[model samples]
Target: MRLRIRPASRLQGAHRVPGDKSLSHRALLFAALAEGTSRLSGWLPAADCEATLRCVRALGIPVERLGPGDLCVHGRGLQGLRAPIAPLDCGGSGTTMRLLMGILAGFPFPSILTGNAQLSRRPMERVAEPLRRMGAEVHTTDGHAPVFVRGGALRGLRYRLPMASAQVKSALLLAGLYAEGPTTVIEPAPSRDHTERLLAAMGATLERDGEGVTVHPGPRLRPLDLHLPGDPSSAAFLLAAAVLIPGSAVRIPGVLLNPTRLGFVEALQAMGAPVAVAVEGEIAGEPVGTLTACAADRLGPLEVSGPLVPRMIDEFPIFAVVATQAEGTTRVRDAAELRVKESDRIAALAAELRRMGARIEEHPDGFTVHGPTALRGAVVHSHGDHRLAMALAVAGLVAEGGTTVEDAGCIGDSFPGFVETLQALGAEVEALEDPPRP
Candidate 1:
């Protein structure tokens, strides 16, 4: 698929993005482990979340779709999940595979998890190693996917993460629920706490002490009702488009305002972007709020590193787009993890942005962008990454001519209605079938 985007003088409107992806994934998994039926409202019905839903149903859990973003998961209890008759195909979702490994580690059954070519290249040892320490036999193909986990007796152990990862931390914590004793994870920096928050809401015995989190083994989880807020990562693209185009103003309602996920918003404000956040309320222990962004005359340079990297890790691709319109150099460091994503985002962003005439440099850990450059539209590739596809589309909105992003159908992985949403905000964008090679 190809997405052609033309320069838009302004984007103006009020929009509401889909439910938070991270929360949506956890909600389904937690619901499947609860003792009774769990009702979820505003769940993200994207490709990635669908991979999780498929896996749970394969495990004998009954999941019903009440509406577009509404679901009711009839859990099979912690020890009630039946062994699957076939291998679990996780599609392209790393979150589904890693978190599911944790859950399977506690079950006394053998399970094999696999994915597509992209996900197959992603390392699974970050999760497999910890589960191994807890007495689960886990094997991977050269540290990549096609993970084979043989469940047995699990004994909780204290482990310190080599790096900060919400997925890895959540995996360990989830596996801890089936261990013989308390499982504790110490992080070098704080990652997203959606897992810890949702677990606590489900009546799991867990505690957060500074950089360390501990989870106690439980026989069952209490099902509860939840309403997920709009994803902050998805909201970043709308906010970025609003600020970069002159005379543009966008209001995004019911966005998740989790402090851990607000680094991008903070970076925008510090760079002099006209952005405001108002807290509305809390649902399922996560903050909910509204974000309003308007066009700005100029944006200043900003530096991001260390603890801040994990907080805004998923937003860097779009942040690179915003930097191109800023006044000075924006430096991002300590984000080497970008290399292991669906695409090597550092290399992908640097190469594609350069094609659009942006002054950018790539590094092992991060990238640097020198801005206020006059960009001209050129063809770019999505490299099968959802975030990269959306960020490139944002770049096209400010370019002088039409920009076509190749293989953009991958956007369905996270944001299913991304193009439609952009069109609603007055952007000239369309999805077209890619032309065949001569």
Candidate 2:
């Protein structure tokens, strides 16, 4: 697919992105492990979350879709999931693959997990190693996908994370649910705590001591009545578009305001972008809020590193778009983790934005953008990454002409209504069928 983005005069209006993708994936999985029926509202219906949904069904859980983002998952208690009759296809979702490996590690059965080409290339050993510590026999194809797991009795574990990863942490927590005794995970820095929040809300006993989080096994997780907030990562694109185009103003409501996920918003504010956040209430132990961003007269440079990297890890692509318009150089360090995402985001961001005429210097860990440079519209590619596709679209809004992003169908992986939201905000973004080639 191709997305044609014409420069917009300004973006204006209030719009909401999809429900939190991380929370959505965890909600489905946690719901499936509960002792009763779990009703989830505002769950993401995108391709990534669908992989988790499909896997749970394949494991004998019955889920009913009441509406577009509403689901009723009849959880089959922690020890009740049946063995899958076939291999579980995880699509292009590493979250689904990794988290399921943790859950499946506790069952007394064997399961094979597979994915598409992109997901197949992603390393799974980070998750596999910890599951192995708990006595689950896990085998990976060269530390990548086509993961095989033979579940059995698990012993409690005490492992410190080499890197801060919400996915890896969540996997260990889920696996800990079936372990004998307490499973403790220590983090070097804080990552998103959605899994811990959701697990605690579902009646799991979680003990927190600074960077160490321990999950005590044996509680029957209760069903959840959840109303998830909008995705902060997805909301970053629209808010960024508002900040980039002069005279633009936009509001995104009901977004998850987890402190760990607000690094992008904080960075934008520090760069002199007119971004404001207001906490509205709490939902299922997670904060829900609204974010408003307006075009700034000038944006300063950004230098982000240390603990903040993991907070906004998923938002770097769109944040890079915002950085292109900031005065002086914007440097991103401590984000080598970007290399292993759906695509090598640092390299991909630098290459595609350079095509639009932004001056970028790519590095092994991250990249630096010497910006306030004029961008000219040019055709780019998404590298089959959803975040990169959306970021490129935002960049097109401020470029001199039309920007075409090829292989952009992957936007549906997270933000399905992205184009429609841009249109609602008065941006001219159209999804076109790609031209055939010889």
Candidate 3:
């Protein structure tokens, strides 16, 4: 698939993005572990979340699609999940495979977890090593996927995370639910807390004190209805478009405003982008709100590092695009995690953006962008990465000529209606099926 984007005068309007992908994945998984039917509205029905749904059903959990982005998951209780007859294929979702590994570790059954080529390369040992410590027999091909697990008696242990990863922490917590004692995860820095928040909302016995979170073995989880907010990550590209294009103003409604996930928005504000937030309320312990962004007269370069990296880890690709139009230099450090994503994002971003005339330098941990460069359109590759595809498209909006993105079908992995949403905001973008190869 190819996406052709042309320079646009402006992007102006209001739009709502898909449900928060992170929350959607957690909602479905947690719902399946509850004691009764759990209703979820505004769930992201993207490829990634679908992988979780498939795996949940494979475990004998009945999941019914009530409507578009709506679902009712019949909870199978903590001990009710049955052994699957076949290997669980997680497709390209690392979240599905990693978090599910934690849950599968507690079940007294053997299970195999695998995914597509991209996921197969992602390191699963971060998850497997900890599960092994809890008495689950976990094996992986090298450090990658095709993770095999044989459930056994689990004894909770206090483990300090080597790296700050929400998936790793969530996996331990989920496995903790079945351990003989309390399972505690001590983090050097905080990661996204969707797993912690949702678990607590479902009546799991969990506690958070500073950098440590502990979960006690729970008898059962209480099912609850939830309405998820629009994904802030998905909303990020649109917000960037509004900030970079002259005369552009956009209002995005009902976006997840979890403080842990607002690093990107905060970065934009730091760089002089007119970004504002109006808190709507809280749902299932996660904050919900509307975000408004407008083009800035001048955007100064900013520094991104430390604890902020985990908060906006997924947003850096687009952040690189925004940096190209800002004054001075933007430095991003302490984001080595980018190396292990769907693609090596730091390298991919530097290479692809350079094709479009941006001054970017790749580093071991992150990258540096020197900006206010006059960008010209050029063909860029997605490397089968969805976020890179969207970020490249946003770059196209500001380039001098038509920009083409190859292998863009992968965008469906996270943001299904990305192109349509951009068009609605007045961007000249078109999606082509099987365009002639060069």
Candidate 4:
């Protein structure tokens, strides 16, 4: 797929993005572990979340698809999962693979998990090593996927995470549910807490002790009956479009306003983008809100590091686009984790953005952008990364000429209606099937 975008005067309207992907994954998995039928609304219908749904079904959980964003899961309690006859394929979702390892660790059977080529390259040792400490027989293929786990008796572990990872933390907590004692995970800095929030709402015994979360075994998780909030990460691209294009104003309502996930919005504000946030209420123990962003006359530079890196990690690709139009240098560091995503985001962002005439430098950990330079349209590639595809599209909205983004089909992995939403907001963008090679 290819996305051809032309410069837009402005973007306007109240557009709601898809349900939070992170929350969507946790909801389905947690509901599958509960005792009764769980009805979930506003669930994400993207490729990644679909992978989790498929894995849950393979594990003998019955799920009914009521709508595009709704589901009914019949859970059979903590130890109810039946062993799969074949290996469970997770598609391209790291969350599905890591979280499943934790859940499968306590069952008295063996299961193998595999994924697509991209996922197979992602390191699973971070998750596999800890599951091993808890007495689960876990083996990874040279620290990658095609992981094997044999469930059995387990003991709780007090493991301190070497880095901040919500996936790793959630995996351990999920495994803790079946262990003989309390399992605690300590974080270097807080990551997204969707797993913790959902676990507590489902009646799990969860404890929070400054940078640490402990989940004790033995509580029956209650079924979730709640509507999930929109993904803030997805909303970031739209908001960045508004901020970059002159005379633009856009609003997104009912977005997940978790502090750990709002770093992108905060970064925009620091860079002088006129972004407004209002907390309306809570859903499933996570804060929900509306966000309004308008065009900024000029955006200042931003310097990101430390704890803030993980919060806005996913948005850096789009943020790199915004940085191109800022008045000064925008530097990002401590985000070496970006290297291990579906693509090496640091190199991809730097390479693709530079193709569009931005002055940028790639670093081993992050990148540096010196901007306020006029951008000219050029053909760019998504590197098979969804966020990179969307970010490049936003850059197209402000560039001088038509911008073509190649291999953009990956955008459906997270934001399904990305092109349509931008067009509805009055951005001149079109999606087309790529021409055959001669």
* Clash counts for the predictions, in order: 0, 0, 0, 0
For candidate 1, write residues 218-242 as lDDT tens digits: 7579996988899999999999999
Q: Rate the local accuracy (lDDT) of all candidates.
A: 0.94, 0.94, 0.95, 0.94
Poorest 10 consecutive residues by lDDT, candidate 3: 218-227
TM-score of each: 0.98, 0.99, 0.99, 0.99
Q: Rate residue 35 of model 3 by lDDT.
A: 92
Candidate 4 residues 329-411, lDDT tens each? 99999999999999999999999999999999989999999989899999999998999999999999999999999999999
lDDT over C-alpha atoms for residue 308 of model 1: 90
* Least well predicted 10-residue stretch by lDDT in candidate 1: 218-227
lDDT sort, best first:
3, 1, 4, 2
Return the clash pairs for model 4, or none.
Answer: none
- Clashes in predicted model 1: 0
Could you give candidate 3's per-residue lDDT for residues 1-438 as a string of tens digits?
A: 899999999999999999999999999998898999999999999999999999999999999998979899999788888899999999999999999999999988999998999999999999999899999999999998899988779999899999899999999999999999999999989899999998988889998888999999966899979999999999999999999999999999999999989999999999999999899899999999999999999999999999999999999999999999999999999999999999999999999999999999999999999999989999999999999999999999999999999999999999999999999999999999984659
Residue 58 lDDT in candidate 1:
93
- Pick out the ten consecutive residues of candidate 4 with the lowest summed lDDT: 77-86
